[model samples]
Every structure is written in structure tokens, then in C-alpha cells.
Target: MDLLSIKDPRFLKDMNIEQLEKLSEEVRQFLIEKLSVTGGHIGPNLGVVELTIALHKVFTSPRDKIIWDVGHQSYVHKILTGRACEFDTLRQYKGLCGFPKRNESEHDVWETGHSSTSLSAAMGMAISRDLKNEKSYVLPVIGDGALTGGMALEALNHIGHEKKDMIVILNDNEMSIAPNVGALHNVLGQLRTAGKYNWVKDELEYLLKKIPAVGGKLASTAERVKDSLKYLFVSGMFFEELGFTYLGPVDGHNYEDLLENLHYAKKTSGPVLLHVITKKGKGYHPAESDKTGTWHGTGPYKIETGDFVKPKQAPPAWSSLVSETVRKLAREDDRIVAITPAMPVGSKLEGFASEFPDRMFDVGIAEQHATTVAAGIATQNMKPFLAIYSTFLQRAYDQVVHDICRQNLNVFIGIDRAGLVGADGETHQGVFDIAFLRHLPNLVLMMPKDENEGQHMVNTAVNYDDGPIALRFPRGNGYGVKMDEKLIQIPIGTWEVLKEGTDAVILTFGTTIPMCMEAAELLEKQGVSVRVVNARFIKPMDVEMLKSIFAEGLPILTVEEACLQGGFGSGVLEHAEEMGVYGHPIRRMGIPDRFIEHGNVDQLLEEIDLTSKAISEKITAMVPKKKQQRA
Candidate 1:
């Protein structure tokens, strides 16, 4: 079958089992080929080929809804929903989104980028359907990893009690980003080997009903006694206790099993948990064998060898540098412990975990719980290093303010991917941490200018016991600067001048530091002597430096690779206002008040005018003709 010719999944209903099996293979090859050129969530999408096809075949979409959790694995759904033509432009600027977009297609009724949200959204939709007297299935396909989230569990409890007519598809692939970790994962493990509990129930009830007189009542009594059988054979009864009718450990890839289970779920009343077993990265050999999550998401790779494409030479990754430094420090300090919310691979904490196994804790997919756990550990006078992505950290905002900041506990937060993360788009961008975290009392926020300073800042954060301090680092590799043999702690609330000047000063940090330097050099050739200051500490502004620059009567320009409102630039502006240093011109340049989409970092930066040329132009306008003559 020509997969591109598939405009919608309506044709799937007409195909037999053999044709469906063949179509699945074609879809896999299509994904394996297209995703090689335009990188994406290939492993996830590859795993769900048959399952997605079977779903569209069983249910009527755009009316009978299917809400995907995280929506990363919706690539197969996209192909079946008349989106094959947009494959070339996947994850590019103004192109196909990596996650579900409501406007993209009518089939995409719900949009999701974060996990554990589908169940709650499903509940909302189910309730709306009930109130309107509508007849449609509300199926939320959530993974086992997502099921461990607090929100998912909360939704499960409510869903069971309400006894709403909804089918919850539990896609148990045994992984979420990294290998799933928790007690919940262990329970699912039991269900995988618990051969067809529903079949046992049906056979036992049939045999009992065949007995002549009083057999019907006897069979009904045996049905109640089946709870003991559930406890023995499988833990899926765990779902039964929560008010759901547990279905099966069906083979997700098998057309017969998936179709049968899905058909059963549609007819059942109340909430049903149809547990379907799938293999992540099911088709391609290299992705299938990837145990370390290397193939979960990827750049372009050679099809034959499966080797990822790369630059000739690259600097050390920021994640590796930070994690390795933590490993080195943990060698001496017993109180120093590392924690991540199930990002051991992405945060490069495997080395740290290997070195100090006892001190490492990975609280899976629970950012809120992880933050409070760090605060609890801090109460015992232990130094807890919480390594979390900036975008995910938003989920723990309340914990940050209420628990960590309020008590002034010594929690060290390594805000990884602290700037504009490319390709993942607005849902996963790390551009809002400073805006949200800066307002909280008793919190110190700082970003490093380069790799060398980044290491020092990490050292500074670990040793600082005054209160909660955070070190922000950008995504991707460092600047490849030479490192110091000894790790030294930088003084708190201090700023350094990179280039001396008589005209305007450019205040910036982290990813934008190099760009500001280039802008300064460009202005120098054009006779404007610009000063570049690496204002690393965001919360505690460099008061002395601000006073000196204000006294010098130099115009100020603040630049950041973050949101413009309530960000690092906002901190600078607030300081100027409080100090009554108002005569000089102050201009702020950063990401505008909107969400940035998927693309390369350079193109996204260029689109927002956060480049050297834009900075040069802004600074040039600030400095006058007479100031140039004086310099």
C-alpha cells in the first residue's frame, strides 16, 4: 500500500487483518526514512504503528475521541489523518508540530506535550458528553510511565468512583524517556505475565452456569469470589478496586489482540483499563536494542549503521560537565546527594549514579514530589542537588515557593536547559524559569557566562548554605574553554566586566554572553566604545557595579535569552528604578511576549532579533555623536 495516499483512516475499516499487517510495515518504513532526515520522536512513533492503526479502525474519530498523553507518539496518528504531505517540514519553523496541535487536524481534539494530563482531560470531556446527552467513547491512551504521576493517580481515583463510561488505554511500553522507575512499574510487571485474567473469569462463570438448578445464583456468588483469583493471577485487580473493569495484557502489535480488546472496551460500561503491551522502538534493530534511551529522540542518523550524524568536533555537553563535576564533589562530601525526576540519561547523571549509587535518587516523573523531597533532606542538614529541566520545573512552582524558599532550606537546584531549547517547540522550551523563580523570596538565581564559569557556579551553589541557590545552564555543548584544575566558588551577587568602555554597557549572562561580546566588538569598529558586563547573578543584582556604571553616566542595555517580562532584564530595570538612576536610557532586548516554535537555535534567535547585529543596532542608537568624540 502507498502510505502517502492514505488521506484518512476511514479506509482502514475496509482492510482485512493481512492488509492491516502489511500497512503497519509500510508505516514503520515511512517513519524510519522520514525521521532520519527530519529528526523526531521516532522510537515512540515506531512502537505504536499497529496500535494506532487498530484504534482508528475500531473507533470513529473526531466524534469518538482518542486523547494521547504527551502526544510525542502521535506521529503514526498524524500520518493516518492526512498529514503525510507535511513530513519533510516536521519540527521546523512554521511546520508540523512534534506534539498534537488542535488546529492541525480535526482528529486532534486535545493538545498535550506534558505527560499525565490525558486522564484529567479525558475526565473533562467525558463529563461534558454526559451533560450534553451525547454518545461517544472518551478513550485516553496513557503510558505506564505516565500512570505513576500524582495527577494520573488522582484522576484514576475520581474516574473509578464516578463510574463514568470511559476507556483508559494503558500503553505499557516499560519506558518513559528513560526506563521507568517506581512501585507502580513493578505492579505492571506482574500484570504482563498474568495470562488473560478476563478469560479465566469467563470460563469459570460458564462452567458454573451449566450446572442445572440454583446454578445461576451459584455462578453469581463465584463472580464475587473472583476477587481472590485476581489477587493471585494479576495485579490488574488493583484497577478493579479503583472502580475500573480491568481488561487484559493484550499484545499491542498483534492486529487480532488489539482489535478484540479495543472492541471489548468500547462496549463496556464505566471506566475500563485496557492494558496493552508494546515494545518501544519495535521495528528498527538499533532503536529496539537501545537500553540507554539514546534512540528515544535523535538527530539525523545513517540508516545502515544507525550511527547518529555529528559535527567533526564538538565541545563537552553542559549536562555532562555539570554531572561529572557533581560526581567529583560527591566523592568527598557525604551529605551531597543528587536527585532527578527520571532524567538520568538526558541530565547525564548516569556517571554520578554509578559513582555514588547510595546518594543518587531518581524520583520518576514527579517534579513536585522531588522538590519537596529535596527540602525534606535539607532539613536533616544534607546538601540535596536537584537536577531538573527548566520547563519541567514549572510543575513544582508551589513547592519552590512554599517549601524550599519559605523555610530558607539549603537546596541546590541545577536548572538544566535554562534557555531556548530548539526543536521541542514552546511546550518544552526552557525560557520561563527566571521569570517564575525570581519573584520568590529567599531564592538566588544565577546563570554562567561559559563552561569554565559554569563549573565554578556549580561549586558555589553546592557550598552555599545560606538559603536556596540555583545555577542555570543552557542546552547543548559549552564554549570549549580551558578549565581550572581546582573547583573554586564564585562570590555571591557579583558581576564581572568582560570589556571596558566609555559608552553604553550591555548586561547579559549565559548563552547571550558571547553574542553581546561580538556586538561590543562590532560597535568598537564603528567608534562606539561599548562595555560588556557578565551579570551572572540574577536575583541579587550587582549593586556596586550598578552604582559605578550609573555614576559614569553610561546608557544601559540588558539582554537575555529568556522571556522579556519578569525575567533577568526585568530584575535590572527594577534595580534602576529603585536606585533612582533614571536619566540615562535603558532598553531591554529578549524573547518577545509569545511562544517560540520548533527550529534550529540560530534561526529562532534570528526570528526574535536576539542576535549580535540587532544588539549592535540597539546600542548604536543609544550612544550620541558627542560621546563618540569624547571616547
Candidate 2:
């Protein structure tokens, strides 16, 4: 019953129900064994085994396009589509990606990483199918947690209104990294109860219809009554109201039920939504019991006990440091409040939530709502810290521009993971915050050089009464710098000169600052004196110091853990140009135009030529050959 050994594409088609069920168990076991070593999404994948099997059994993939929303739940899909052998390299550099990558396989219809994108992508695919007169089924497996995203809702409205022929499978595990919230979860709960009643009603109507013409009207009446009861008792008419044929609160784990529903949906769809109820970690005991969202996605762990293999080095994470600092700050100021869009654990706001329960808010998966809500709170003279990942914040771009920035609200935007987020890859990188946030008027943006500086930046954001201030930090631990207890406010728009040199100046912030310092040290050994400056603030340029550096006419090398174009270096170039210092050659260093793939942070940096060795070599060569000093 080893499913991994079944290599034939036609193997699933020939399998009987009992064999398929065995295959589901085998797939779960395979995932557990592989993931324990590689460290991938454990719980979400375990839940979708049967659902994925039923999907492949019912519809032909490639011909029938399947778009997986958020893509974390696509591990089962990957395994079923013959990528099981490649899964050992999950989330590693130059290996299999954690999310669905279009280049990896034809079975993966769309390249998706962030939530709520499936519906929109599926809608487009469905429309294309219709236009081309193609008979392919467009199935988008979107989770209940993802449905909370505004874009998903927007697509739902459009698809329903347009009457697009597509199937939206609502994989309701009732979680998205964190436990789901808001009215949507409640609606799914009510639908689940109503689906239970459907079985009894269906049997009763069948018995009533057996009596011919006299009982025909009675059965019809009963059916109408049952429909009325559905509206009154069950809450899933939300999808029905939106013009979708609401099918079930079907058992997602039940292979036959999944196959049946999927077959039905494939045949009769003019926008059908199958509300599939599933446990996140269905078969796996450890993942099923996980409440902290720890097992959602992770590094290699022991399969038996579900514990991570001890990471060789134990440095305090940047997230924990930020969380602790917020908890400490909030104890003194009641005006201080914490807000995250369903990422209390990811943002490390668990400590803040424990300490200030009333003040902390997890605003579901609606980043837009979280931002506007922060703006509303800030309007009332409260300092609200809106903590969210950089890529996910793209969802709330309009809200940040309209609600907060337009009004110049005093909301503290704690843009976490603000650079190349390693293994999660291109879709999840925190590289665009500087490009997006810096352009907006009345916004102050800064990134910390180390953990200690991060604490100071957080304090500065809270204390500043002027306008909205953002403190962006990277994904992992800081460089083991001693954290300060007292909340010290570093001056905004100031750059700290780490190493002064005559050859060139390397300005950087966040995780890249450490790498820049290393480059400076190496260059110094080669007798190339390089100046290293931590340009903390992106919005407000360090005009005085920049002018002094420009006046020196040294080759200015700007380094950041952000996108090279329209980032910190671009900001510096803009300032230099405005000050008529454009004649000086400026070399900008950071992530390139291409989407960075899954890898360790160091390897990723090296791949992009952002490493200390690369930087030192590039700068050493860039420094002019100065007449050889007449030896």
C-alpha cells in the first residue's frame, strides 16, 4: 500500500474505493516521514489527502485547471501528482518549493503563495476557458480562512454577478496560520449543522414521493418547507444569496463523499461552492492537536514526538524580541494597542496578547480592515501598532494610503519580515515596503541594524507624536547584540556611521547591515578603507551626512536587504540628484529584479551577490587605481 511506489499516472484511475482510502493513509504517512526531515507544512497537508485524491480521481489535471489558494495546502496535491519523490527538498534553495510553483509541474495551474488569490486566478482561468470554448473544469481550492480576505470576497462578488462557470472548493479547516475569526467562521458552523439535517429530509421526501400523484404535491410542499427551514436554521445561504449553488458541509476526509461532490460540481457548475469541513491535521495526532499554529509550517522535526531537531545555534529571535518589547511598552502606556490580521503567532504578538488582552486584536485575515481599524483607534488619540508581514501588507496598500497616510494618522506600522524572507520564497519576501511606504507623504520609515537598535526604533515610533512611523525588521534573530531594557528613542532621519573610511561608503539597514560591516572589515584588510553607515530611515534622508559623503566624492555604495530599484539606495540617489551630487557614481546593492527562490538567508544573499565577500570584491575593484603611489 505504498502510494509513493505507484508511479504510473493511470494508477489512481484504476484504484477501487478501499484501495484509494488505503492510498490516503499511505500518503499521510509518506508526508509525515518526509516532512519530519525536511520541515514543511504538516497540518494543512495532512488534512487535504482525501480531498486531493478525490480531485484527481474526478477531474483530469492540466486539462482541468486546479488553482490552489495560498498554496501551503498543495502538498497533498503535489504528492498525488507524482512530486512525492522531490518533497525531501521542500523549502530548500534550488529544491522543491513549499508553495505551488508553475514551473515545477503542469498539475500546478497557478503560482500562488499569499491567501485569497485563488478565486481571482480561477475566475480568470474560467473566463479564458469559456472564451476559448474549452471543456476544462476550473477548480479553485480556497480555504475558509482565505475567504476572509477582501480580494477573495471581491472575486466572489464578480464571479457570482458574472455567472462564471467554475467550482470554488471552500476547504474549511477554520484556520489560516492562526484560528479563523469573524462572521464567515460562524456562517460555516451554521451550514455544518444544516447539512446534518439534509440527510433526514432527503429520505423523508423520497418516501413521500412513492405514493404517486396524491403524494407528489405533499412531497413538493415538504421540499419547500425543508428549503424554508434551511434559510431559517442554516446560515450557508450566504453563498446561495451570492448566486452560487451551495452544495455541502461535506466531510472532506470522506473519500467517497469528496469524489461524489466533486463529480457533481464538475458536471453542473455555473458557480458552485462545496463547503468542505476538514481537520487541519486529519490523521496525524501531533498536528491535529496543535493549537499554537507551530505545526502549520516548520523546520525538520522528530516524527514520533513532533519536536524540532535542536537548531545548532540558539539565538533569541527578532520576533520574540519585538513581542517582548511591545509587552513591556504597553504596560506603561494604556494608549498603546497591538493589531495583527490573523498573525499573532507569526508576528510574535502572543506575549503582547497575554499581557494586554484587551488592547491586542487579531482582525481575522483582513489586513485592510486591520489598517483602517488601526486608523480609527489612532484617531481617538491611541497609539496602535499594526504589525504585519511585508508581502501580506500588499493586501492593505489602499487602506494604508487612504485611511492612515492620507489622514496622517499616528498609527505605528511595525512592518515585520521586511526583506528577503528565505525559505518561503519570492511571494513572501518583505522587500517592497521601502518602495511602497517611502513614497507616501507624512510617513516615516526606518529599519534596525540589530536587535538593540530595533528596540530603540520601536520606542521611537511609540513616542513620536508627529505622524505615522514604521519600523521594519527581518525574519530571523538579530546578530546577538545585548538588548537594552530602557526604551530609548533614537532620532528619526539619522544614519549611524559604523566604520569610517576614505575609499567608499556602504550605507545599509536591517539584516544587511551586519553583512555590510563584514564587507567593510574585509575591504580594510585589503587596504581599501570603506565607510559603513546604517541608514536607518528610508523616508527621511540623512541630508547633512549624505552631503558630507557626497562632498568627499568617494564612490557611494548603498546596501540594503530590500529591492535595489526604488529602495534605500534609490532614495539616496534621489537625494544626491536633488542636491546636484549626481556626477558621483553610485552603486546600489540589494535583491535584484528577479524573484528570489527558497534558500537559507546566507545562501540567498550570496546567490544575489549581496554577501560580504562579493561586496568587498566589488568595492575593491570599484575603487579607482590611484596612480600606484609611485612605489
Candidate 3:
């Protein structure tokens, strides 16, 4: 079987168990080799090789609608569905997506990057099928960790009440990035140890039948004893009580077990929860031994030794710079506490967690709860640093508005990955945070130009008792700039002037500052004086600086690596309009009003014309020829 040349999973249905086993081995090898060169969610895909094969065997996709929650594990499915040839360019610029894409193949019925969404999507599909009188199955494969999400639980409750004919595959690998926490994870743990329901059912029936002919009282006692067996043997009674017919904690790697349970689930009338137990990073040793979740997703690595390919020496990661700064502040301030929604590893809060074990909270995947909890913590006169990714913060907008902003509590929010996050693409990009957070009352939003500024901002956020303040930082490493010996609290609404000029001003912050500087340098060679201002404070918009610039009558160019609509540029425009300085020639450069796709960061920046070349060209055109000649 040529893995690369393979097309469609229809061929899988005809293959015997031995052939499928061989194919699974080949797939593990293929993923190990390819993903080593082109990095991806290798651990997850490797874990699901057999389960994905079994799924394709048991149900007909496209017609049977297999919706994957947080579709990172769908690489196996993609390969089976004729995408094996696209492995070399995985997660590269304009290459194979890390997650499922509807445009990539018809077999991808639903697209997903976030967790705990598949159940709702599957329910909708099931209802539509019922309405149209269609005969295909609707199966949503969710993970044990995602089951704890508030949305997932709400959908579960609704699906159970509706009792729709859908099969829910609970892929229990005891982890979601980090080891799962909260009450739901404990329930799944108990279910893992509990004996199979079928075995207990048969034994109970046999025991009941052995009872001699007895009176009503004796028969009632026997019936009571039989019913008690359900509680003793079946740990999934929780889901059963919710109206879903629960199936076994089947071995996900075993082909026979997976197929049998899947077939049974397909035949069942109402909703069924088929619990399939799997091992995360089942085949690969380095990924398998990952206790801290470092191997969950990775960059290119050495195949022979599993050593990650290094860039010789690199600056400290932005996440580390922020989290470490928070940890440092937390040592002095007893009120400072850290919280993350099940991303301690990604957020780089392991050190903080270890130091302040009692104060650090990894509240699972419940962003809504995390937000409200921070608000609650803030109400008690304690500072809560809610560290979350920019994209995930979108889920807790209501909480941010109603609970945090309305009350005007002092909550520090560290918005990590607050710009175009390359590789992960549109669904995971952090471009929308500024747009969403800037308009909220009693909230101050800012971004830092470098690691040193980031530290000061973190200090500023933790020490501020005024209202809720957020610091947005981009993905990957910082610029390795020199740090000051003592921390200083930066004044709110203050913007820094990095370069002095007379002809034009380029106002930007964070990752876009370097580009602005480079563009200004290029413009200097052509005799154009371009001023670069780090517009760190997004909301308050350095009004004094704006007035001075407007009085100087310098042409302005606003550059940001965020959405232009209702973003920092929009804020600048609003300020100008209010100040009656609308005559100044102003141009905004940023991500246009479109969802950016997955690609290299530099490539994506170039695509949107946010490069130094584009900025220099725009600024050169804006300034007058006489001004350049005078310089």
C-alpha cells in the first residue's frame, strides 16, 4: 500500500484487520518522518491512527458526517482521505492547514480549531437530518478535557433532553494540552477503572435468573439488587442519567473493540456516548513520555534523537517575559494571583504555579468562568492576573463587559499572542482583541514595543488600582533588549517617542515597531524625516502627543499588526476628528478587513502590505517634495 498515492477512505472498508494494522503502522511512520521536517500536532495524530482508521471503517464519511472537535487530531483522517501528498508543506505559507478546512476536502464536514464546539455543530446537523428525512449518521468525536467546557456541557444537556439519534464519541486520553482538571475529569477517571457494562449486565442477568420461584417481596428484592449493579459496574451512569445510552470505555487502539462499539452505536436509536480510551502519543517514545505537554505540538525536530532543531541562540519567549515578570511582582505583592484557562504550559506560568501553588489557578477550559472568577477575586481587593491567549479571550467577552468592566474592578489581563499568530491561522490569530477590548468602559489596553517595555507594562498592570488593564503581547520570542535593574510603573495613557523627525510621524507599537523603524531608516536615505512613536496605550491614545503632532502639521502614518477596523488606527482617527484636526494627511496600514489565513509571519505581513518596504513607499508618497528637498 503506497501511502502517498492513496486516495479516499472507501478502500479502508474493504481491508481486513491485518491490512488495517499494517496501514496504521505505516501511518505512524509517515507522520513521524514528515512531521519531523514540517512540524504539527504529531502526538495527537499519532494517538488517533487506529481510532481514525476504525472510524472510517465503521461509518461512511461525507454522507455520515464525522465532525471532529478541535480538529488538530484530524491529520490521520486527512491522510486517509487523500491528503497524504500534502504532508511536506504542513502549516507552511499557503500549504496544508493544521486543522480541518472545508475547502480542502468534502470529507471535512465541519471546521474546528477551538475545543468543545463539535457537539453543538453535530446537534444542528442531526436536527437537519431529521427534518430532511436523511438516513446518514451524525457522530461528533469530543475529548474528555473539552467535556468540561461550559458550552459543551450546555450542548450535552440539550442533546440529552432532545434524545436525538446521534453518536457521541468521547475520546478520553486524560489530557487537553496539560493533564485535565476539574470535576468532569474525575468522573472520566472513575469510568476508566470501572469494569465493562456488558460483562456486569450478563453476570447480573445470570444471577437474577438463578433465583427460585418466589413471592412479590423476594422478587422486588432481586430487582432492587439488579438495579444496584448498574451503580456498581457502570461508571458512565452520569451520562445515562442525562438520557444518553452509554457504551463501554473501549480500547481506542484495538481495532476489534472500536469497530464493535462503533457499529453498535450506529444501530442505536437515541443519543449514544461511546467512551473510547486512547493514549496520547501512543507510538512515538519522546511524545509518549511527555508529562508536561511539551510534545503536544512542536516545531521541526531531529528524528533520530527527538531533539528540537534549535536556532543556536534566541531571546526569551514573550510568554516567559510576561509570566516571569508577573511572578516577580507576585513575590512582593501578596494580593497578586495568576489564573489561566487550562494553558499553564502555553502561557508559561509553570514557574509562578510552582512558587505560588495556592494562588495560581488553572481553571480548565472554562474561559467564561476564568473571567468571572477574576472579577470575583478583584471584588475582594485582590489583584487577579488572568493570563489567556488573545483568540480564546473572545469567548469571554460577555463576562469581561458585564462582570469586570461594569463593576470597575482592578483585574490585570495578560493577553498573550495578541497579533497575527502564524502557523495556527485565522481561527487562532489574536488580531481581534484590541478591537473588542478598546471600546469597553473602565478598561485600559496597551501593547509593549519590546521585552523591557513588556516588563514595565506588567508591573504597571499589577500595581494599578484604577480599573481593569490589559497588556497585549505577540507570539514567539522577544527582541532580547537590555533590561533595567529596577522596575518602574509606566504612567497610564503615555506613549513613547522612539525617533524624532519633522516631516512625518509613524505611530505604532509591539511587533510592528521594528517595521516602522526600518521604514523610517529607508525614508531617511531619500531625505524624508519620519518620526516613530510607540503608541503603547491603545485606549487613551496619548492625546497630548497627538495635539503636538497635529500642531506640527506632520503627515501621520499609523501602523499595527491588528485589524484596522475599530482598532488603534480607528482610535487615532476618532481622536483627530474630535480635536478638529481632520485636515492632516493620515494613512493607516494594518491587516485589512479580512480573516488572515495560515502562513509564515513575514509572508502574511507582506501579503497585507505591512512590511517596511510598503510603509516607506506609503510615507514617501505622503510627504511633500519641497519638504524632502529642504531636509
How much is the lDDT of residue 577 in candidate 3?
93
Residue pairs in collision within model 3: none
10 residues in a row with least lDDT, candidate 3: 227-236
Better of 2 and 3 by lDDT: 3
Q: Which ranking of candidates, highest lDDT first?
A: 3, 1, 2
List model 2 lDDT by residue over 544-576, tens digit each. Answer: 999999998989888888887788888888888
Compose the digit string of candidate 1's lDDT tens values, residues 454-572.
Answer: 88998899899999999899899998899999999999999999999888999999899889999999989888999999999998989999988888888899999999999887887
- Cα lDDT of candidate 2 equals 0.85
> What is candidate 1's TM-score against the reference?
0.98
CA displacement after TM-score superposition, residue 484 of candidate 2 (Å): 2.2
Error of 1 at 366 (Å): 0.8
Best by lDDT: 3
TM-scores of the candidates in the order shown: 0.98, 0.95, 0.97
lDDT of 3 at 410: 97
**Candidate 2: worst-modelled 10 consecutive residues by lDDT:** 622-631
Model 2, position 178, has a per-residue lDDT of 88
lDDT tens string, model 3, 201-276? 7678898888896888988998888767768785547898888878888999999899888988888899999999
